[model samples]
Target chain A: MEVKLASSYGFCFGVKRAIDIAQKYENSATMGPLIHNKNEIDRLQNDYKVGLYRDLNEVKPNDTVIIRTHGIPKQDLKDLRAKDAKVINATCPFVTTPQQIVKKMSQEGYSILIFGDSEHPEVKGVKSYGEDLEDVHVILEKSELDNLNFKHDKIATVAQTTRKKEIYLDIVNSLILKNKEVRVFNTICDATFENQDAARDLSKEVDVMIIIGGKNSSNTKQLHTISLENCSDSYLIENETELDSSWFDNKKLCGITAGASTPDWIIQQVVDKIKKY
Target chain B: MEVKLASSYGFCFGVKRAIDIAQKYENSATMGPLIHNKNEIDRLQNDYKVGLYRDLNEVKPNDTVIIRTHGIPKQDLKDLRAKDAKVINATCPFVTTPQQIVKKMSQEGYSILIFGDSEHPEVKGVKSYGEDLEDVHVILEKSELDNLNFKHDKIATVAQTTRKKEIYLDIVNSLILKNKEVRVFNTICDATFENQDAARDLSKEVDVMIIIGGKNSSNTKQLHTISLENCSDSYLIENETELDSSWFDNKKLCGITAGASTPDWIIQQVVDKIKKY
Candidate 1:
């Protein structure tokens, strides 16, 4: 069997930057998981003594706290700062753009429409940046636009950094038709687009596809979704331990793609284990 | 046989306003057919003594030159003003809006995308309103977007007054995905939307659909297209003379929908002819 990897797989620039920063500040506690990948978080804790704390209450006043790549809400950052904690901002610069836009556009009285999953931390954090939280709406699908009743004819929209560009534009177009004026910012990062495109391209040429990343990772899920659409025998696994040899029974070619948060070490381990077949 | 008319059919507000303005000025000549319906133009010439001239050269210095409902190119307007002719601005308010947006947005360095037929006068007039003619692109289909090489990241789009909303929105969505920023003005008139919707509603309950308006009428052709999709036995007719008795043979119900430019008198004549069958 032949094993092929996507040309643009493994950790993206933002995630790599976050890891590099966290590694330098050993024994520091991250506000949340530094990135979405579980194996990477485990490795960080075991090797570098980095700690993961979900809430601000868990951090000591003088302890160094590292912000996750997804960033924290404005209130949380204020709370951290008020406690006199040493803060290292590792928020992806792409995510920072939409936060600034939401704050500026909302201040200008344009109702903000954020195209993203509402429960995701990136979306939650971006929502906090708006001047008026009441005016900001997190929409996951196009159908949500119909449910919206807005008093403001002027609206502005921005998408999460990892969102599919097509879905973001679809909602923007619908909003543009209903409102008199709309300003849209395409905030999807180039790395996310490249990873998805690479996965899609690899899937088309392979008989069986294996996607390696955390199940909860949005970018990972998107890659798995794109792979499944192109190749029927596609599986998403977090680690090599979950890989089944049965998947390679009749497959001549196996394609692999990892999400943005997935580290190079985990991907190499998965490839070595697959070669054992 | 039962005859039914669309609730929102016949002369729309803009067309009616143009005709009302023209009737008030006797012996005046329209730059072109004031509206798409030829029958109405003939009626104006015979009863109202308003002639239709295709060129500005035909108008005397003191002659009242009535601009068509679709409006004229910017250069033509300037020439008419330069000649000191008495000009009646009958350009539809709905059509005038996109003209203003194209001019303003283009001046602000936005590449204009017009969802319209390339040969249509209204689209041509709107295109001429842009600050740079080279920056304006008339896209009739989505595939044309691939051929575009845009220098500016900012794109502003508007649709012709008679276009389908879905088609306009589809192109806008595509443009939004490709461009960094997009400003869209949905210029499809309310009357056109209402007429198409009413036609779709009527087609569902009828055995045969008869669409009435001028052959060259864009909105008329759109109505016929909508009718054909819902009811296979749909036909387009300009007047009572085109009605065939065989179309009504064994037909229990027939629905009639007139375009925005179709006058009430012509619709009545078609209904009368259908009733005789």
Candidate 2:
């Protein structure tokens, strides 16, 4: 089978920046997983001696702490500063923009609505910026809006950087239809759009699709989901080892795509393995 | 034929407030038509002896000028103040919100996208607030967006208060899909939503639909357009005098609705005349 790569795929500006920062600050510990990709984190840990602190309590005084791309909660950042840890913020600018917008708008008495997974680190961090926690709602579906009781008529909404634009638009349209004064901030990363668009285009022409990215990575999952819509024989794998030769038995062409958090090296391995199959 | 009125219709809060202000300030001249309804303007002119000034040049120094509900351009307001005219600002708060948002966002270096008719007074007023006029674009259709050359990546969009929510959503979705940092202000008025929803509901249940308001009124034209979507025999009339007996022929159930600027008295006349037919 012939292996083809998507026109736009793999490490986005934010993920690339975070990786660079992680590499530059060797021996420094990140507040959370620097990026969603476990393989990339492992590489950073082995090569640069970068350590991961899943909990804030793990960090010691005088330690250099690098903030992850998804960012930490406001209170956590304050606590880290109070602990006297030398902080190196590597939070994505796209993620930071929504945080600022939520802080400013919520402070000005506008109810905040975040269109993203509530359990996500990016969403949790953005939600913390709202002045009134009760007024800040994180919802994944448009139907969830019916359960929300907004304290203020004015609402400001922002989407997670790695989310699908169509889903974000659905939530925004629902908010606009119900609320009189809604402010929607489009915070979905540009790389996410390009990657998803490229995957969707390539998946249609190929007999089988292989999406390479961390299983937990939101943007990668989005790309896999989009590829599944076009090609039924689509598979999501972290590396070449996870690839099944049986899936590509009758496949004349194999299209490859990776999430924003995925590294080029991993994609190259996946492409090489598919060519061997 | 049975004449059934829509659940929500007639003069909205803005129009009612404008009318009340016009009545209170007798002998004053409105900078433009106070509302879109010609019959109501005639009532204000005849009953309160209020004058209408089509042009700013018609106003003499010290003339009391009541700003229209749609609002005049920023420069026009300044000129009126410079002429020492006593201006009783009657611009709707809903309309003012978009004007302020456009002025603030545009001044902060964001490109402005106005989803409305370029010739509309409300759009004209809101467009004037943009600090950089070159970056402000007034587009009626999503296709028009392709022709626009934006200097800034950050864009702020606002809809005309009287516009269709669905069309506005289409424009917003299109903007969000293309731009990374789009700020959407849902300036579509609450009354507009209620009126359109009510008209749509009532039109679906009736054999014929009659929309009452000024022919030139944006909201009134929108009501007629929506009514036509569900009811093929939809008719738009200014008052009972415009109604024809032929329209009621074989029509068993007639639905009635009026635009935001339409008066209840005119709606009552249309219903009473429809019953007679």
Candidate 3:
């Protein structure tokens, strides 16, 4: 059995930056999680007095606020600032690009639609960028575009940085069919593309595929999702310990791919463990 | 501003499909030009079609022959009864999905990355159904991925139905970085998301965004490329005559967009008319 790895895999710019920033701020938090990782977030809780608040309403004026890579709404920032909260903005640049576009188009009175998960923080941030549109449609399916009755002739379409390109275009194409105007800026991150392409390729040549990353990571999730499409003998795991050897019983060739949030050490560990098998 | 309409815009799904299958059989002219768009493949005409013996040299009894989206690959239906030539297919499931994946994956290597340009007919055709790579990358980056490196794994990436998505992931963030394994599916339907989005939005906004389709009339070229983008003003016109007197003045808000293969209607028409302003 041979082992294969992707050409473009592992921690991306944003994830690398987030991890670094979170580590830097770890000293200040007392009881709150500083990062999204269960292990890392847990470490932060034990180290600092920082507490995660579901909403800012619970936050006092003097408390510190650390924004995640998903990013918070711009308006929320304004309100947070109004209340005199110290903020550590860790918004990924790719995520910020869509917000900028939505903000500009919205200022010009363009109705907005965000192509991504409705609850994603990045999408929420993008929606907040809209000054005029009260709520932006979060399109999920190709059929959803068919159902949309876009009111404005002026509509600006922005994708949450992590959304798939195929789904994004479907909505844009549907809008074109309806004769509604749509300016779409495909803002999905370069990292997500890299991860996906790498995983898809790695999975194909291997008897079994293993996609590693934070389960909550959108890009990681996408990598895992893409891997499943390419190889049935695949598994999505957060770290090496999640390995289930029974699935590999008949498989000799193995391929390994990891998402952006996954640490290099974890991926190496998986590679070593797979080699042992 | 001199509005330069893209040479390949109104590529209907059918045309895109045809082109996809043709490109895959690049070594041989398995069939005629997949799509009828001259401008789309101007390079191919003068660059490659050179051959000595046209017929039998193209394929042998066991050798594979491809049929485009308009057709199928290698040894399809016609030769299936007789072992004349092996079939290689590039049929769009938008032309044949329900039969293949659900059936094939039910027994064999279900994991596959059928590559082709996302918007092209051929790629869209093959990808028309189930268990393909999740979140297909529409492959439109002008640059590369985080770093120009291949992964250490295997990937089952495929191409678009029309054109190929290069396996090259450009190092956009930094050209110099760690090397990784990569499997790339080059799926680029020459007529892609950019034009669709641009045309749709341009048509619905501004004094008027012109539609440049053939007098021969292909609905694909006449596509909406028409969507709303801004509040100032928006309108759509097929040709210069469709332009109303009210649309122009010494000073007016004019935004122009065109479809694929729309020659100006010929670059000349667009230049001459816009020059009048």
Top candidate when judged by TM-score against the true structure: 2
Q: Residues A1-277, candidate 3: write the lDDT tens digits.
A: 4678888888677767766676676533211233446655554556653456666686677666777776777877888788777777767777778788888877777777877777766677777777765535677777776556655765667666455565665565555334323454546566767767778887777779888887777777777778888788778898889998896898888888887656677788888988887
Comparing to the true complex, what docking class would candidate 3 get?
A: incorrect
Residue-level lDDT tens digits of model 3 in B52-150: 223444455654455544433222344442647655554544445423532243233233334334565444434444343342232434343322232
Ranking by TM-score: 2, 1, 3
lDDT of 2 by residue, B59-129 (tens): 99888999999898999999999999999999988779889999999988899998889998888998999
TM-score of each: 0.74, 0.75, 0.44
Q: What would the per-residue lDDT of candidate 1 be over residues B128-241, giving only the tens digit for each residue?
A: 999988889998888888887766898988888455677777777777667777876657777768888899999999999999987887879989999999899999998899
Which 10-residue span in candidate 1 chain B carries the lowest summed lDDT?
B161-170
List per-prediction Cα lDDT, in the order shown.
0.87, 0.88, 0.56
Tell me how large the interface RMSD of candidate 2 is. Answer: 2.3
Displacement of the residue B157 alpha carbon in candidate 3, Å = 32
What iRMS does model 3 reach?
13.4
Interface RMSD of each: 1.8, 2.3, 13.4
Candidate 3 residue-wise lDDT at A184: 48
DockQ score of the complex predicted as candidate 1: 0.41
Docking class of 2: acceptable
